[model samples]
Target: MNHDKEPAKTGTKAGARGLPVLESETLFQGRNEIVIRHQGAEYRMKITRQGKLILNK
Candidate 1:
């Protein structure tokens, strides 16, 4: 009988594939809204009063 547990991942590669990691605290910068541009398109990300995130295109 073998009882072995795999060690947890703690490296940058642990995140989702091909997705760049950014800290919300740094991105938000104490503001509720931030603009993001992708593929020549502009989008807005906002934090609601309830502390939830909302994205608008």
Candidate 2:
């Protein structure tokens, strides 16, 4: 079995399909929920108990 881990990219650049890539650990900052404000609207991002991410408006 392979146990190698890929290096984390910390550069500011677009990832796959020209989309921006960000690290979740950095975004969450040890929290399970975060609020994102876009165009005067607020959205919530949370990690479920099963380790799945969910975004709600």
Model 2, range 16-56, lDDT digits (tens) per residue?
66665678886777899999899999999999999899999
TM-score of candidate 2 against the unseen true structure:
0.68
Q: Against the true structure, whose TM-score is highest?
A: 2
| Candidate 2 clash pair list | none
Compared with the true structure, all predictions reach lDDT values of 0.74, 0.79
Q: Put down candidate 1 lDDT per residue, 1-57, tens digits, no spaces.
A: 123644322335435685545667767768999888999999999999999999999
lDDT over C-alpha atoms for residue 27 of model 1: 70
Residue pairs whose backbone atoms clash in candidate 1: none
Clashes of each: 0, 0
